[model samples]
Structure formats: C-alpha cells, structure tokens
Target chain A: MSCAKPLSWETLVDWWAADLDEAGTSSVEEHLLGCDVCSAVARRVAATAEALRSMVPPVVRPEQLAEMFRRGVRILENPIAPGQTCDFHFPKNADLAVHVLGGLALAPGASVEVTLRSLASGTVLGHVEDAPFDAQRGAVYLACQRDYAQLDHDLVAEVRVGKDRPAARYTILHHW
Target chain B: MLSASDTVVPSRWYRLGSMMTEATDSALLAAIAAGGAGRREAERALCRRYAPRIRLYGLRHLRDEDRGRDLVQTVLLGVLEASREGRVREPEQLVRFVLGTCRNAVLRLRELEGRAQPATDEVLVAAAGGEAPRDPVNAAVLLRCLGSLGDRARRVLELSFHEELESEEVATRLALSRGNVRVIRHRALAALRACLDAPARGAA
Candidate 1:
C-alpha cells in the first residue's frame, strides 16, 4: 500500500538542508519509521543531494572552492596566468578540474565569461559564461569536473563580459 | 509533481510494513521492555522499522556511508540494551528516545573523529535524513540533469551544498529571499528527480 501520510518535498529538502526544527525532525522520523514509501522518497532526495554535493560546477566562488578542500575533494588546480600556458594532468581520483585564469583587468561589477576553445582545431570545448571574479588578484576562476577535461590538446579561455571584446586570455597545455 | 512515487523503493521495506501481524511502535517497545519470550521478535521488528531511519541520521550527521551502516547497528544495539536494562525513560515516546540516542551517538562519533568536546547539553534540532545506499544516484545521469538546470537553480544548489552555506547566507549571496531559495531548491530538485527518473537514452 502507498504511504497514507507522505511528507512534502519541501519538508524533506529543509530537513536535508538542516533547516527543520525539533518538531519537524520528529515528525519526519516518525513518518519514516512507519511509512516505507515516504522513506523511499527521502532516499531519492538524499541521493540527488549527494550527487550534486560531489559535483563541481563549471565555475565556483573561492569560498566554495575552499569548502571542497575542507571536504577532502581532490582538486587539480591549474593556475595559468593570462597570456601564459600550462599543461593539465588530471590525477587519478580527481574531483575538481579547475583552471584559475589570473592577471585579468576586469572592471568591477562586470560579468565574466570564459569560453573554452581547443587551440589546434579551434573547436569550442565548452562555454562557461558564469565566472566568479577575484577582485584582489584580478582573476577569474573557471572549472568543471575531471570527466569534462579533454587530454592532449591545448585550449584557450576566451574571457569576455557581456557584448564586450576579450578582457583577457589564458592557455592550458595537456598532460596526464 | 514529485511525490513519494517518484523513486522506486526497496522491496524489503515494503515487506516489513505490510506484514499482517505487525505491531504498533508502542506495542513493539512494550514487548521489548517487558522482557519475555516475545522480546527477541519485538526487537527484530523494532530494528526493521528504525534501522533505516537511524542510518539516514548517521549519513546526515556523520557524512560517511560506512559510518551510516555503523550507526544502524550501533543504534539497534543501544536500543536493545536500553530496553533490557529498563532505561527507556519514556517507552511511549520511543521515537524521541531513539532520536536522542542517535544524536548522542553522532556527538560521540565527532569526539572520536578529533572534534573535541561533543555537546552534551545542547538542545539539538531534529534533522532527519534518508537511507543512503552504496551506489545511490548515477553520477553521469545526475550531471546531465544538473547541466540542464537553469542558472539560478544551479547557483542555488552550488551555494547550498557546494559552499555548505545556510539558507540566509545563500539568500544573501544569491540576492534572493530565504523563502525563494527554498522554493527554487525544491523545484530544482524536483526537476533533477524527473530527469533522473527518465530512462537514459543509451540504456538498453
């Protein structure tokens, strides 16, 4: 039989986010202990959250990046200065494949975009338009998971802002 | 549209809940605490009911799969011991008792993991979680789902989980109200669930 008393997804998310209070927590646990159906739903929500938790977006803020370090997520940080080139070797069991594009003179409050394109064939590997800027270092951090990293090809970060010319460019060589 | 039916439940749980002779939580506790011929059976039933719940608690608090499994066994053993010793303060409120035990266990675990002085007197909020299997969501499929998310949804998730930020911090960072963040996260999670539930194009 289906669960007669099902908790809402919003409640489950709040529970996962630690947003629920004492009464809410008890109610969920009580429901879970009694209703197998609701328990199953809660599991899916958790699994989905876990999947997202382990993933590294195309771009992340410095604090988010540091949180990965705190979580022991192995990151292969490729810091390449604009107009400079460095190779990438995605080590085994790597979680984050980051390319820190440094030495940009972006105007404050300007939206940064990093369009990754292959150097040899000029094919666009991926276009990550949402970038987090480090105003102090004048850098833009661009990243994705290790699975998205292509091997044995030099690529360029065609950095730009909305409807503007290239602000800066960084090159990444291939390795591993 | 995301409801309890959105994902497939393990058959074992269904069997546990559907058994005709199943007793209520209070009855199970009374039997276990009363101590007699029906005690073992009651304890087994109790474990069947709450093992998954406690494991989920461990997953949320401890954040490790092995630890989650450990918690299921540990809590079951603790409950059994508590029943045998007649130490269950409120047999009627066994859910709270179990939850309290789970919290204490997590605090002890944190202490062992080098985070000194687990809070003994702190009033903890009851934050329940879900049963996490060894292989949960398919990573590749989930990545596709995440990629299909809108910028705002994706950013909300990133802020919530990636940065481990609370609702207020996430709201401040994303420039959305806390209520808005919750709604977006809920909708985005439902969307991801839909994508995850759909048959993979390449799957046979």
Candidate 2:
C-alpha cells in the first residue's frame, strides 16, 4: 500500500506465470515485497494458481495426458473411429479413461465441440465447446475418471465441428 | 510489468505483511526478543503472517511442495531463534531477513543435493518469493469458475500449472504465440479471482 503506482493485474499475472526473464522476476519481487498493494493481488492470483493446478478438467491436452503417464498414472485409451461402438474394459490399474473420437475431417478455422452423454439415462456427462481438436490427426479426445464409468450402461462421446449435429459419435460400452 | 529497469524502490522492503491490525511486526519481534508469556503467541503471529510467502517461495524456486513447506518451517524457526537471542538487530527488516533466509536455505539445500548447481543468477528466486497469508479457495467455487472459461484457456492453465510446462512449451502445444499464451492464461485466472472475490465482498 506504500506504493503510489501499484503493480497491475497484468504484471502480477506475469509474475504468477513465472516465465519472466531474471530482471523481470527481480523487479516483480522487489516491488511485491515492498508494496503491500501488489502483495494482496499476487496472493489471490497464487491461490487461484494453486487451485488450477490441482484441477483436472474433463478434457485434456496431449502434453497433459503424457505428463499423467509420466507420473505413473495408468490410463486406458480407447481409439474409436467415427460411428464406431468400442467396448472398453478399464484395467484395474487404470486411473483415467480416454475416448479418442477419430476420423473427423476438421475444416480449417472450425470451432470443434465435444459432448459426453450417458447411453442409458441420456444424461449429459460432460460437454466442451471450443474443444482442442487435432486437425492434422483428425481426432478429439474426451477423458473422465475411470472409476466413475464402471457401470452396466454405455457412454458415448459425440464430436462436432462448426455444426449443430455431431459429425462423429463413438460409443463406449463400459465392462467393469 | 516492472522490468529490471523499474528500480525506483522506496526501501529494500521486507515489511510486506498481513494481520497488520493486531500488532506491528516490530512489536512481535520485540515480544519474541523479550521472551515473555506472549513470546510464543508473538512468534506464532509472525509465522502466520509470513509462512505463506515463504512456502510459495520454496515451491517455485525449489520446484517441490515438500521443500517449500520445509523452507517455511526452517526459515520461521531461524527467525524465532534469532529474535529470542537478540541476534536480529532490526525487527523492521524481518521481510528482508525472511527473504534472505529463504535464499540461504535454498542455497544450502542445493549444496545438499550434491555440489552447488551453477548460480545462474536466474529469476526463479525472485518469482517464487511472492507471498500472502495462505488462503484456502473453495474447491466447488473454483470448479464453477473454471467451467466458465473456454476450453483453450482451461487447457492452457492445466498445461502451465499442473503439468508445469513453460510458456514456450504450452504455446507450442496449443499453437499459440508465447505472449498470447501468457495473456490468455492470466485473463482466465483474473476472472476466477474476481469471481471468488465477489461473494466475499458481499458477505463482508
């Protein structure tokens, strides 16, 4: 609070990002340690960062999936082509169940969407708009807690690109 | 962002603190030095205000949560002991003391890891010192806020924070420029903070 010109959110975020050069880092910490105003902002941002790190979204990126594997987390990946009904049996060691909806011809500049629905109850398990799609690989990935899907009912992942209707629907029949 | 060029510091600040209304840091330091009945309470008060900053410092610099917690305990203990022995001449400079202790402790830790790594004079040290009283964010609220973001923003944060990816790596994975990634990532986090701060304001 002693600072007349306090650090902005952008600067604090940059600090939170921790990607700044050495000088940038020093400047931020120098001001942060001295300026109570900036310290308050940085604290909230840091807490949010802590929460974000612990969070596992329904969707994940390739690097995230890879990191999970590196951490020794077991994953059961079911690669299903469009309109294919894949029978997935989650191994006892599996922590995550991934459904890769492949074979979608994503046109350039297309906004991809993914929906995970329960086949029996018609419950929408999850939905992601602006899903990150691999245009070159022609695929979209949907992941969920493996233990949650150990049931008699089937689960289906539908993928759509810049369209109201799904271009690809891959069904997952979970066999515990 | 305050670059290395923005060096108009008021003082070498170690006074960045919380729980300010109850007592001044100098008072707390004086209490500990006197070793009266309130000495233990004063030490706890001081630690409560500064432990979060030190823990955060340990986490980012040492790159380990356990190490961060370790650093907080170690540094606070040093502060407490030094205060009791009247070794700390300037109670006002505890912030500087804590920050310096963290660096020293970290250096000792590095030495223990086998031969000191090159002190490449990296920014990791300063960036990690960002501190505030530890606040527990509501998990349900955070998830709800997270659910509001676009998939790209959420993925960006996941990769950056959880996966511990550099901006360059995240940019490469998402096919975004490094600057773009930083902007998007912070904006999402800022919104989350705003949302969390909103209800607290109303309640308060």
Candidate 3:
C-alpha cells in the first residue's frame, strides 16, 4: 500500500472518495500530504465532489440547534403555565434562562427553589434557593450556569414548590 | 433554481463557533487523543470542520437525506470515541482518516439495508489525474466550459451528476446507449478540466 510512484488517477479518486482500505488510504494520504502534484489532484477531486453534491437537493435539513437558539429567544414570548414544565435544550456554557411558564403557586411565604441536576449521574450541577420570583408575572427564574462539559449528557431542571407541592421538571436537551 | 455553478456547501456552516480555527488537524487530533477539558472542544471543532463534506458524501451514495444525516453523526461520533481510546493515529493525515471512516459508514449502511451489490465509489474516477487541473477551477471559467458543451452532452452530465441518476436510468431518459452516455460525460468533463486549467482569457 506504500505508494512509491505517483498513484494512478483512479487510485487518487478512490483515495479522495475513501474507497481504499485503511492501509491503501493511509499510503495515498501520506503521499498527498507531501506530494504537490498528488495534493493538487486531491483538491480537484474534492472540487468535483463538491460540484456533484450541489446538484443534489439537501436531504438533511439545516441544524435544529439554531432553531433551538431561537426558541430560547421565544421562550419569553409565551408564559409558562402555572404548572407547565419548561424544557430547555442547549449546549454547555450557553447563557440560558430557565423559563417557568405560568409561574409557580407558592405557599404563604415560601420561596421558589430551582436546581439543575445531571440526569445521568444525579449530580447537582447548579442550585439557587429562594430564587427571585415575579408574583405579578407568576414566574420564577434561574440562570443556567452548568459547564458545557457537564452538559455532554442529558440534564434536568427541577423547581421545588415549598415542601409539599410537586416539582416541575424541565429536561435539558443539548445537541453539541 | 440551477444557474450553472455546481458547488453545494452546507448552509450556515460558518457558524460552528470553533475556538481552534487556527489549529492544525494534527494539533486538534492531538488534543482529542490527549483526553482533557480541551478534548471536547477539539472534537467539536473537528466535527464542525468535516461534517458537511461527510454528509455530502453520504447523500451521494445513500441517496437519502436522512441516511446521509445518519452517516455524518455516525462517522463523527465514531472518530471522537475512537480518538478517545487512542484508536485514531497519524493526525496529520486527517482528511484520509475522515474519508476512511466515511467509507466504512457507507459500507455499514449498505449492509444494514441489505443491498445485494456493492456500491461503486468511482463516479468521479474519470476526472482524476493529468497535470493537476487548477486547484479550484474559477467558477466563471467552469460555467463557461460547461456552457460550451453540446446540448446532449451537457444534459447527460446534468442527469448523471446533478440528478444523480444511474447510468441505465440516464440512458433510458436521454434515449442514448449506456456507453454513449458515459462517453459524452467523460468527454464533457475533459473539456471542463481543460478549460479550468487554461489561463484566464485576458491573461498575459
């Protein structure tokens, strides 16, 4: 598989398209990395592949991650119901706000408690006690400060309503 | 709709938010293989850099957009996982590594689908080699070259490459023999390559 001499056009094309086995591909790639002539051919083959790809309509839609981003923006537009669980999915290190729709119904003077936990390991990634709640807007808020590394897996945001009410859970779905 | 130039880059590709834009593939792979906080960032950067091309390769072979999407995720995830385990080597030959993984992904897909025959990966074989054509043939020059081709030849290329139809289907649709279809395509591509390699019209 060591391409001593320049590889044939067919072999280069195969290399470009990854048609060769590991050893053959490695040989061709090693040569292309150092050989100007072969590298130039590899570039051209890539260009042709790019051209052919243009002819085909996109089978896969654009990343939904962008849409999720916009959703973060629109989350404020619609108020979460009193008991509605707001689901937020985003990558780590994102400056995201947990939107609890319709706000929570707190006891006489009980404050809202928001906690971000890893669903996989049951680790508490972030916590906020007696979090600032807008009673007029019936909403509670917490800043999502978990490390992106912590977000490599699934996560959940739990809101505790005092000591007796059911907690509203928001599943964090991140695509990165 | 289809105005001449046939290059299709994935949309919004520049928004990958990579911090290692200046890092070489070797460096990125090294970081990935080293295993640390930087590994995740490097893996993300590498995936962003190559996912579009890998997806395009899948689309061409699998002929289904969803399957193509699957190929992209599968291959990239495999690379990240493999690199973590010290399975990937020779980071300098990064392109080949990605391509090799892509081929394996396609073959696996083919097997899963129970395709009776092996998929041919040489559709562009005829365009290979020869005094390495201009690294990236000028778009205007390429369009002019494609425009200069005879109608039937152009149509043949359109049907074959653009439409991605099989040779038999292209022949049936164009009312030409399969051999005739291939000849026209080969000749047309040659002409395009020559035009691309030639100096711009006003060059000294």
Model 3 chain A: lowest-lDDT 10 consecutive positions:
A56-65
Top of the candidates by TM-score: 1
Give me candidate 3's TM-score against the actual structure: 0.37
Task: Give one digit per residue, the lDDT tens place, for model 1 in B104-167.
Answer: 8778777787332322211110111233432455544555567678878977987786567898
State the weakest 10-residue window (summed lDDT) of model 2 chain A. Answer: A144-153
Q: What are the per-residue Cα lDDT tens digits for candidate 2 across A57-118?
A: 66676667788899988888878898889877778777777777788887656898887777
What tens-digit string does per-residue lDDT give for candidate 2 at B142-191? 55566567778877887888677899999999999999999998888787
Identify the runs in model 3 with alpha carbons over 4 angstroms from their true place.
A1-176, B1-19, B114-149, B158-183, B186-204
The regions of model 2 sitting more than 4 angstroms off are A1-6, A21-24, A30-40, A57-142, A146-155, A158-168, A172-176, B1-21, B110-147, B150-159, B162-181, B194-204
Interface RMSD of each: 3.3, 4.7, 15.3
TM-score of the second chain, each candidate in turn, equals 0.73, 0.62, 0.55
Give the TM-score of each candidate. 0.68, 0.60, 0.37
Off by over 4 Å in 1: A60-97, A100-111, A116-146, A149-156, A161-176, B1-45, B62-70, B86-93, B107-140, B199-204
Model 1: DockQ against the native? Answer: 0.33
Report, for all candidates in order, the number of backbone clashes: 0, 2, 7
**Candidate numbers, best TM-score first, in rank order:** 1, 2, 3
